[model samples]
Target: MILIGQYDSPFVRRVAIALRLYGFNFQHRPWSTFGDAELIAAYNPLRRVPTLVLDNGETLIESAMILDYLDELAGPEKALIAARGPQRRQCLKSCALATGLADKAVSLLYERVLRKDHPSQIWVERCEAQIGAVLDALEKERAAIASPFWFGTRIGHADVAVACALRFTGEAHAGVFDDVRHPALADHASRCEAMQVFREFVQPLIPPKG
Candidate 1:
């Protein structure tokens, strides 16, 4: 398998981390959507990161779809998410919240950096509010979990998603995220970053300068 896109993106980073946890070997392209738009468009018409090129010449776009395929490949017991029941719903909900936070962070960053001349304060404020709301909800959920991982003792999709999103949020927005407000989430991100897989597959966030 070939994984395209830089790890600076939370979406790409989460997929790369999951591949390592699932013991799947793949080549990393580390392409930038800004610089490698044409190259990425060949594999993904939408020109998005986290495009997974399968061994048999099939391509998968979007992190969630790639993750779903990988979960199936890893089998039910070893999958990063619960295969069924309430646990699955909980994991999915957590992932949705984390991803939504990441989406807002990306939007906010673009609004500030890319739209220098006409950046909308309203859009920035809206995105900031959404990011804060998601973080508050996730912090409460993670705080209530007494176990090491979000779902339980074992690491799951929710744990990875939240950690990746938190890292990106801090990197992209600088002082926007308050650690005191989300201590559990801060700790969770730190623990995940300490892992060898995360260390190996990660990239420093490089926000565009004004």
Candidate 2:
């Protein structure tokens, strides 16, 4: 499998980390969607990062879809998510929240960096407020988890999602996740960073200039 796009994106990075965790053989093509539009367009109409191209010439776009495929490949027991019940829904819900946070961070970034005019200051404030709310919710959510993983005692996709989302959030926004307001989340961030896989995925990105 060939994974396209850069790890600076939480969406892409989560899929990459999951592939590594699953011990799946894949190649990374660090193409930038912004600068390498034609290259990304050749493979994915979405022109999105983390597009997975299978060896058989099949393509998967969007991180969640790619992740579901990966989990299926891993089978029920080894799958990164629970296959049934409310537990599965909760786990997916957590992943969605984290993903939403990452999405907002990216939006905030693009607005600040790529646009000729600044976004509505109210919208910016709303986005930041929502990001903080998500972080706090994640902290409480993580605390409830029985293990280091997001749901249950097993290491699963939720853990990967949260870890990747937080990494992108911190770097993309340049220190907006203040530690004082989110001690548990700060601790959670530490645990994610302590993992070699997470560390391997995180380097540095071009900080969004405001």
Candidate 3:
């Protein structure tokens, strides 16, 4: 199996960290959708990073889809998410929100970094507001997470999602994350960053660009 993308991408980092946690052995190819457009397009025409090539040479695109597929591979007993229930729905919802936050962050950064013409300040303000709102919501959610993991007693997709999102935001805008604004979120992110799998696989890197 092969995982393509640099860890600089929070989306790619999430997949890598999950692969590590799941104890899956895969070859890591640090491909970028920017300079390596052709390489990424070979597996994902959308030219997105973090494309996973299964052992049989099947390619998986989209972080969410890749994660669900990987979760299924965990077998019934070791599934990352609860098999069924309202709790499961709530957990999935939180994960969605977290990933959405990360997506917005990436959009904002690209707007600032990629475009030759400056992106609209109004749009940037709107996205930043959304980021703040989501972080606040996550703070409340974290307070309710009694266990070390996000969803429940076991580590799950929800935890992976939240951790990756926070990791991205924190790295992109240093000192933006703190106990004052998001105590629970700060604590949760700190704990996750200290994990062996996370520390080894998910830290921000020297971002490879075109």
Give per-residue CA lDDT, model 2, range 1-210, as digits (tens): 999988888888898888988889899899888788789998999888889999999999888889989999988888888899988998899899999999988888777777637567887888899998999898887766657666656668777788788878888786788778777667777877798888777657785444
Candidate 3 runs further than 4 Å off = 203-210
Total backbone collisions for each predicted model: 0, 0, 0
Give the alpha carbon lDDT tens digit for every residue of 100-189 in model 1.
Answer: 999999999999899989999999899999999999999899899888898778888999999999999999988777789999998898
lDDT values, one for every candidate? 0.92, 0.83, 0.82
Q: Candidate 2, TM-score vs. the true structure?
A: 0.93
Instruction: Give model 3's TM-score versus the native structure.
Output: 0.93
> Which residue runs of candidate 1 sit more than 4 Å off their true CA positions?
none
lDDT value, residue 70 of candidate 2: 94
Cα TM-score per model: 0.98, 0.93, 0.93
